[model samples]
Target: MTYSLPRQLSSLLLATSILLWSCESFAPRPPPQRKVIVTGAAGRTGKLVFSSLLKQANFYPMGLVKSEKSAKKIIKDNAECGLENVWICDVTKLDSDNEGSLPNGIRGSDAMIICTSAVPKLRKRHLAKALLKAPINMLAGKKPLDFKTLQFYFAPGQHPEKVDYEGQIAQIDLAKKLGVSHVVLVSSMGGTNPDDFLNTLGKDKDGNGDGDILVWKRKAERYLVESGLQYTIIHPGHLKDTPGGLSELWLDVDDNIMMSPSHHMMSRCDVARLCVASLKVSGGQSSSFDCINIDVPEGTKSRPTEIALIEFLDAETTYDYSTDRKLDYSMNI
Candidate 1:
C-alpha cells in the first residue's frame, strides 16, 4: 500500500536504526590476555620451552628450575639472552640418601609438564633390601647413595621403580593453590595400554603385573585429570633425533596400540616448540593429547606456524584449577 512521505520517512528511520544496532551487536571481540608458566625449565624440554617462549610475541614465560645452582644457570643464560623472570621450584621431594632422585624444579607455573622418569635396573628382591638398608647408610654416617651406587644393585630382568610421581602431584596441587589454570603433561605414548611395555607396575586386563613403571604413570595421569584444572596431556612415542620435522601426529587413549610414529627423534628445540604451542591454544585446556615429530608436509618446506591449543575447560564452569574430570579419547590407524 502506498504511504505518505512522513510515514515513509519514519519507516526508513526505523530500518536505519536496526541496521546500526545489528552492526554494534556483531562486532568482533579482541583477543584475551594470557600468562604462562613452564616447569622443568632447566631440563632439555624445559630449555626448549624457554627458548620458544622467548621467540613468542605474546607469551610471558615463568621458568621453574630445581636448585639454586640451576636457577643461577637459567638466570645467567636468560640474562645473556636478555630474558628475565625465571622461578626456581622443587616439583618432587626425594630422600637424597635414596639413589636416582634427580634435581629439577617446579614453581609459580600456570601449567606443569612432567618430563621426568627413571629406569630401574635392580631386581625387586635386591631393591627391597636397598630400600630397607639405605636409611641405615645415612644413620651410620656413610656416604650418601648416589645414582652410580644405586645402579650397581640392578638385576638384568628387573626395572627401576620411579620415585617422583607423588612429588609431581604435590607440585600440581600447589599450582592449583596458586591459581594456575592449565597443565600440559609430557607423557609417553604407550601409557594408555595395559599390556604395553611402558605399563610396568600397573595392572593389565588379566590383573597381572608387568612392573611398577606404568602403574605410577597411570596414577600420576589420573591425578592430573582429577585436579580440576585445564590440562593437555602429551603422549609422545619412541624418540629419536631426526633431521627434519614430523609429518604425522597420533593421539589415542584406547585400542591397546602402544607405540606409534615418534616425534622424539626431533630436536629438543622442536619439542619445546610444541609445548609452547599447546599453551597458546584457546580451547586446549582440560584435555589430554599426544605429540610426535614427522617429516614436514610435502611441498610445504618451511616449518608451519604452530597451532595454539584449545582449552577443554567448560565455559559454564568457573575454574578453581583444582577440579578436573577423568575423560579419555583415542584415535587409531
Candidate 2:
C-alpha cells in the first residue's frame, strides 16, 4: 500500500504538470515587435526619431545611413542609450550594381521614415568667393540676389533626381516589396507651386528648373500615397534646432503656412516625434499636411501635445495643388 500510494501520487502530479504545460504553450501571445527603419538616421531629425523609438517597448528601430562613418558616429553619440541595429545603405544607389549599394538586411522593414534629402554645396571653386559675397549681397539689399545662380550644386551623382526622387522611389518600392505597412516622409513645404523660390536652389544653368528638389520630393510623396501602403507626408518649414515641446505647432493643408509673409520653422525634435507616432496608430492613415513650429517665449518647456499629434493619424488631409500661387519671398522674416 505504501509503494503503490507514492507511485499513484507521482503519476498524478506528472499528469497535472503536463496539463499546465500544454495550456501555457497554447496561450495567446502579444503581437511581434515591429522593426521600423529610419532613413537618414544619422542626421539631427533622424537621431531624435531613433532615440524616441529606443524608448518605445513595442517598436524595434533600425537606421539606414549612407556611410559606415555615419553609422559609427551615431553609435558613438548614443553610447549611453545604445541602439538595436544600424544598416549602411546608400539610398541614392539602391538600383545600382556599380555604386555603393543597399544592404540586404533592409528587405523586411515594418515601417520606414525617410529623412534623406539631396544636399546642395557651393561649387568648391566658388565656395570662398560665394561666402565672401553672400553676406555683402544680403546687406546691400541686392534686388536680384539668388544663391542658385552660379553658386551651389548638388554633389556629383547626388542631385535631387537621384536623392529626393529616385532614392525615395527605390526605398518605397523595396519597402513595399518587403511587406512594409507604413511610411512617413519628411519633405519640404515649397512643393505646392512649381515656381516656388526654393526650386531655384536646384536650377540648371539654362534657367530650366531641372533639378528642383521640392518638386522631386512631392513626386515621391505622391508615389507613396499611391503605393497602397499607409503613408504620412509631413512638409515641415525651415527646421530649427531648439527643443520641440515649447513651440506652438501649426498644421494646415497644401502649403498654407507659406501664405504668410514667411514660412514658419519647426524643431527637428517635434518632427521626429511625429514620425514615430505615424507607425503607432493602428491601420495607418494615408494623410499629408504642412506643419511649422511657431516660436514661443524663451524658457518655455512642456510635454508635447501627443493626443493632438495622434489625431492626425486618424484624419487624412487632401493636398490641393490647384490653389498654388506665386509666393513673394521678398520679406526678411
Give every collision pair in model 2.
Answer: none
Clashes counted in candidate 1 amount to 40
Q: Which predicted model would earn the best TM-score?
A: 2
The local lDDT score (0 to 100) that residue 283 gets in candidate 2 is 58
Each prediction's Cα lDDT score? 0.54, 0.74
Stretches > 4 Å off in candidate 2: 1-31, 80-84, 95-102, 123-150, 204-210, 261-263, 295-305, 313-316, 321-333
Off by over 4 Å in 1: 1-34, 79-84, 94-110, 119-164, 198-211, 241-248, 252-267, 296-333
Error of 1 at 300 (Å): 4.3
> Candidate 1 — worst ten consecutive residues by lDDT sum?
324-333
Per-residue accuracy of model 1 over 1-333 as CA lDDT, tens digit each: 975679789899999999999999899965642456666777766666675676665766666666778777777776433334565445555333333442222224455555555344444564566677877889899754543333222233233233336655765666676567777776565554534544433333453543445445556777788878877666555554443244543333432234443334335555565666667653544656544555556776544425322222233222222221221222110
